[model samples]
Target: MGNAIGMVEFTSIARGIETSDYMIKAANVELLKSSTVCPGKYIVLIGGTTGDVKVSMSVGEKYGGEYLVDTLMIPNIHSQLIPAICLTNQVENPGAVGVLEFYSIASAITAGDVAAKAANITLIEIKIGYSIGGKGVVVLTGDVGAVLTAVEAAKKQCELLLQTTVIPKPSPKLYETLL
Candidate 1:
């Protein structure tokens, strides 16, 4: 079994709804407790195994502008960080180096699923977080080779099916030829 970590955020309510819908219906995910970190905003936490978790979120009616400015308040006594830090603190066995960070939560879930199915690796845990670009980020720690191979598979899958990139040209540049 292995673990995964990642996070993503969306700016627009429409986009967030789309993403959250994808996760709930297309991915058939279970919802964890919602967070009250952001005022008027809801942060839902959810996870399971490969089949259970499908990384997704929605932009609520409230916007998260500058909300992240608030410093995180993690209680010191036997908190969640302690366990995570302790677990990763140990040295990995041969062929079991923990997977680092993945580009997106979707990709990470896909990678973990692919690894479990194709490589017979188990996804012991998963962590999701918000990315700097407001996109989802996932971090997975599991079998070294399995994680790496899964990353490749997930990347390929993303390239083939998930990713949507847009390139924009300057308005003046486009109008120059017309003028």
Candidate 2:
């Protein structure tokens, strides 16, 4: 058993829904999220052991077919990733905060994982494209140097409109808002 994660994005909701169903049935992976996102796109997230996740993703990709937009598979996903994606992370004493924004949920998730693995930071949140016009947002907290390093590492993975900011000694209200 391992913490592996995978995702598939689709332009057609019908195909996405069908693909998600097939994905779960094809493997022992747990369905994380499967629903329509912003701008009329559909996204499905799944997690399990590395082998199971890989199998599920393969089925999802095959069934996704023409409607597939993008896909991601992380063999060893970070511990904070699921919480961040599900908005269940709790904040602690923070020194600096970093924000990374992307045009796609898959990009944001990929970058978020990179950032988390690159530095000793706490991923505050990884808001997917449920709202905010299909944009993905990642929030993290750590020392100024770590936050900066994490943000920079994450920036390299994005292929679209990306906005990033690092706030040193962020206001408490900012953390509150993020949580």
Candidate 3:
């Protein structure tokens, strides 16, 4: 993982775009993800050294104003987080499975990081926006104990957890569908 990952979610596309541009110009951070999510929201994800990410996020927050819905600056994030967010982490056979849903992308990412660090688990996916009405979802699979621990850790990060579940023994069909 990079030294840090920073994200800013905005309710206004115009403000989000402008703020993202300012962020990139203000620091030496690499733009990871930048696009409009569901419900007309805009999200900007960047990565770099901790100092650079903090500077970029500060610039973004200054420019975001009221349009900013959420901001996240996670230094030394879990190694699996970025890949899961990008939907590139693959699990051939899932064991116990856990899912966490949140109202904000920033919160979801934070929860995922905490969960991953709390237990030995595989992050299956971290889906944001799309058909889920601008919400965020994180999926993980591991031993029953690990899954339970991961879910517990994730729950602590969100004010209102939209949904959280742990399937102790998922059916093969379920794995086929989710993975």
Rank the candidate models, highest TM-score first: 2, 3, 1
Candidate 2 CA-lDDT value: 0.89
Cα deviation of 68 in candidate 3 (Å)? 1.2
TM-score of each: 0.35, 0.95, 0.95
For model 3, what is the C-alpha lDDT against the true structure? 0.90
Compose the digit string of candidate 2's lDDT tens values, residues 38-108: 99999999999999999999999999998999999888888899999998877776779999989888889
The residue ranges of model 1 lying beyond 4 angstroms of the native Cα positions read 1-30, 36-95, 98-100, 130-148, 159-179
**What tens digits encode model 1's per-residue C-alpha lDDT throughout 1-179?**
11321122343344443444455554444444333322223233343344334232222212334332211111111222222322232223223323424434344344444544444333433333332332222233345565566555645654223332211222445323222
- What candidate 2 gets wrong by more than 4 Å, as runs, is none
Model 1: how large is the Cα RMSD against the reference?
A: 15.9
Q: If both were scored by TM-score, which would come out higher, candidate 1 or candidate 2?
A: 2
Weakest ten-residue segment in model 3 by summed lDDT: 153-162
Error of 2 at 4 (Å): 1.0
Error of 1 at 90 (Å): 14
Tens digit of per-residue lDDT, candidate 3, span 1-179? 25699999999998988888999999999998888999999999999999999999999989999898888889999988998989899786579999999988888888889999999999999888877889899999999999999999889766557889999999999988888
